[model samples]
Target: MQNPASANANVTVTVTATATVSDFAELPATASHGPLRIEYRWVNERAGDAPIAVFLHEGLGSIAMWRDWPQTLCERLGMRGLVYSRPGYGLSTPRPHAQKWPADFMTAQACDILPALLDALSIDRDERGRMWVIGHSDGGSIALLYAALHPEALAGAVAIAPHVFVEDISVESIAQTKQLYETTDLRSKLSRYHADVDSAFYGWNDIWLDPAFRQWSIAGEIASIRQPLLAVQGHDDNYGTMAQIDTIAARVPHAQLVKLDACGHSPHRDAPEALNEAIAAFVLKISAS
Candidate 1:
């Protein structure tokens, strides 16, 4: 267990072994958004025939940010798992300052980019049937949105501390993070993993804090997600409130909400044992059905 002191009184204690690149299959990904070339890495290696589980990282997350959770859970469940960095995070392409993400950036990812990436790797969504998605923070919201938009493309989804709508608290927290990134060495530290950390950080932070983004809420989309769903939240998340998961439960009929005590925004990082156990059981139940 690693306990890190934070500006917030609620400190974050993370428990899990960090995995190296060797633990994953670093497959190169290629896609196109006009003339821009997008790059990504995929980790999907399992010994058995369990359902494929795709992992989406958080706002500041990458394949490295996920640590060993993917390998751990996939091994425990005898399932295949995939972890990849999005357009602006980790080793993926940096977001150009000259261009702005569309208002429906997340929608586009779920509707277009993600499918393109899957196709690039020859993972036939229609033939493989439906793959399970395990997403954290912003990635979690993306997963939920993807399930909602393409209900037939997913077997189920698990979201951890997902953001559905912008809140005053979220904006305030991000403002503090901006200060940390600039004044402190947070940006430098992140640079070790990301080639252009600022691009990744500001790209995500700025768009989320935009005034118009407050109107960005996918709770309405949740009503359309018919697949079995699991929403997990930590009691001590500094990013967003529990309402994120509550809204999901209110909309999706088969949604299961797991609230962990003494946990934070990233449940797989803060409580890996509990998370792995829950995911294994949930996957088993789904497979049985």
Candidate 2:
């Protein structure tokens, strides 16, 4: 298929269900990758005028990796959905081999790439104001950033296993993952979703482990968010701890929180029933207000 990102800015193909179709948007040069192609997929688009839920993937996740979760959530919420692979993952453009991500990469995604994408897709001001960002891990951090930086653009934000600050545990786990990637089938498994698995893997891994990243923390900034927010984490999550959500609640007192038992890093997969319910109730409560 030809890259739709190559088309004119005014051109937009209404993305519908994946039913064997895919879509792409061209982000601007000032954005992360600058003039890059971002592969995306949609769900429940027939919901028509329903609030949009944009799913931002985990560090190593992609449109394919999200599988049917976004669809399932949209169905349950009776809302339209938008899920996309970031600049260096899935069928999207890959990062240059020699390029290393900056310590504040997630910030760039929130403040730059995401807004550019919404415009490229022609999401108007009204739609943006009613949109909700649902993200996980690094993506979750991006959601928090977006909500904080541009709260008026979002109806709400959901951060699952997000990192408000750097955790030693996260660095240690990622280092071990690097070893597993080299010695085991980790790369092979991720390759099933990404066009260039190396781009997906290293782009995420390199930054989190960068020495300067130790001082990285968005906890102070997230307090600026005025939109309803939901912070969730798994008690057994290895990548982060309950403090992640705890900090969110501490900063944004109105933020709702859900900590799951018998769950891990991926709560949507580990406890979909509980997660879906929490999110549903949150939307209802906020809408009623």
Candidate 3:
């Protein structure tokens, strides 16, 4: 467990085991965007028969920011795992200074970039029996959006602290983060995980704080997600309330919810063992069915 005191500290935690595979994927340019280079790492590469677990990082997260959780979870399930950085995070292509992200940024990632990355990596949906997505925070929203958009392409999804609709709490927390970035050493700390720290931070921060974003909601759209879904949230999550996952359950009748006490926004970091157990059980049950 990460000590709360050192949660934002600049300390390196070593991974005893190495990743099975690590490489870059050069994605073709799209009509709305230019070419992108994504950085990814894989674990348990030989688990060919098992469903692949794709780990999507948070708004400010990167491949390296996931630490060893992806590896540990894949090892536990005897499954393969893929962890990658989004366009503006980690070693992937950084966003241009003048570029402003659209309000539908997360939707675009789900509908456009994710599929392209899957194709680039040659992870055929038919061959792999549909991939599983494990996403956190902003990534969790992306996962839900993806499942909604491509129900046939996913076996299941584990979304931790996903936002279907923007909340005042989320805006407040993001505002606080922005203050920390400008007044504290937060920017420098985050720089270690991102190539262009400002791009990663400001792009996400600015969009969320936009007055137009207040009305943004994926709730109606996500009702279409037919894949088995597990929505997780910490009782103490500052960015969102329990309504985040509760709304998912209300919309997707079959969706399961896990509320962890004494946990924060990051269940995988704050309550890893419990999170792992829930995910393992959820995935195994779905696979058996």
Candidate 4:
């Protein structure tokens, strides 16, 4: 549990995902992950008339880990923004050391926790209809799942390096990362962002390396997303191949694809200009339609 003194009292949640459309409303809003006190921040918070951009971070990411990218992109798109650290990462509740994430963990996040946060913030149905979801890596996968589950809720989504299915290469890279995390200064570096760095790191790291997690995939699931989606990837990405976005474009036929040259798993960091331009154009086109 986080010391209440440091967390945002306005955002601490006591309600379950059962919040409704009238004011607020599951992995169905009903699948409870129990109580979570999330850590979040608002960008352009006074821009009441503009649409909201909800950002979900990568597997090992926290709000601070996202740096200034969310604020920059939301500004370019003329939108307000919400960025938060999920439970078990950053200042949010830490994952119990004994807990091993189930295969449907990402699904649970999309359906259960994210909605609860939106509700906790008093972002009702109408706001959600005009909202955009932007996420990276595992966060990207959660964004896709949220759109699929609540097809009527979002304006669209920008998924950067999202995984729809597990690949041999992904498992291989994660395996290598485990080695690096132990042998290098990775833990020291990541500790700057997370209160319980081990909770954030090991919770994410242990799951991907688990043999059973190899079969985890949302490939068939994302096919249900009805909104416009832009899938971006770097040709040189070490974590996943272009097949991640390609699969999204194929499954969600209207989904646009942007494969960046000389980029890696994190486009916002590697190619900010190109990524910002692509997302701005996509949001503009969708908003006008």
Measured with C-alpha atoms, the lDDT of residue 37 in candidate 4 is 66
Candidate 3 regions with alpha-carbon error over 4 angstroms: 1-22
Lowest summed lDDT across 10 adjacent residues in model 1 is found at 1-10
Please report, as a residue range, the 10-residue window in candidate 4 with the lowest summed lDDT. 18-27
For residues 130-165, what per-residue lDDT tens digits would candidate 4 score against the true structure?
999998999999999999999999999989998888
lDDT for model 2? 0.85
The candidate that achieves the highest lDDT relative to the unseen native structure: 2
Q: How do the predictions measure up, each by TM-score?
A: 0.86, 0.92, 0.91, 0.89
lDDT of 1 by residue, 1-289 (tens): 0001111122222213322342111223335364323333444453545567888888888766776778878788776876777777665667887666655778767776666666655677563465888888888988988888877778888888898887787888888888898999898777765557777888887887678878888888879988888899889998888888888888886799889888987788788888877877887898788
Candidate 3 collision pairs: none
In candidate 2, residue 163 scores what lDDT?
92
Model 1 residue 194 distance off true place after TM-score fit, in angstroms: 1.2
Worst 10 residues of 2 by lDDT: 1-10
Q: Backbone collision count in every prediction?
A: 0, 0, 0, 6
lDDT, candidate 4, at 287? 82
Q: Please list all clashing residue pairs in model 4, or write none if there are none.
A: 19-24, 19-25, 20-24, 20-25, 26-29, 26-30
Global CA lDDT of candidate 3, please?
0.85
Superposed by TM-score, candidate 2 places the C-alpha of residue 81 at a distance from the truth, in angstroms, of 0.3
TM-score of 1: 0.86
Rank order (by lDDT, best first): 2, 3, 4, 1
Instruction: Give a tens-digit lDDT track for model 2, residues 1-289.
Output: 0012242332233212223246777765753465788887779989999999999999999887788999999998888999988888877789887898898889988988888778777788999998999999999999999999996899999999999998888998999999999999988887877778888899989988889989999999999999999998999998998988999999999999999999999999999999999999998788778
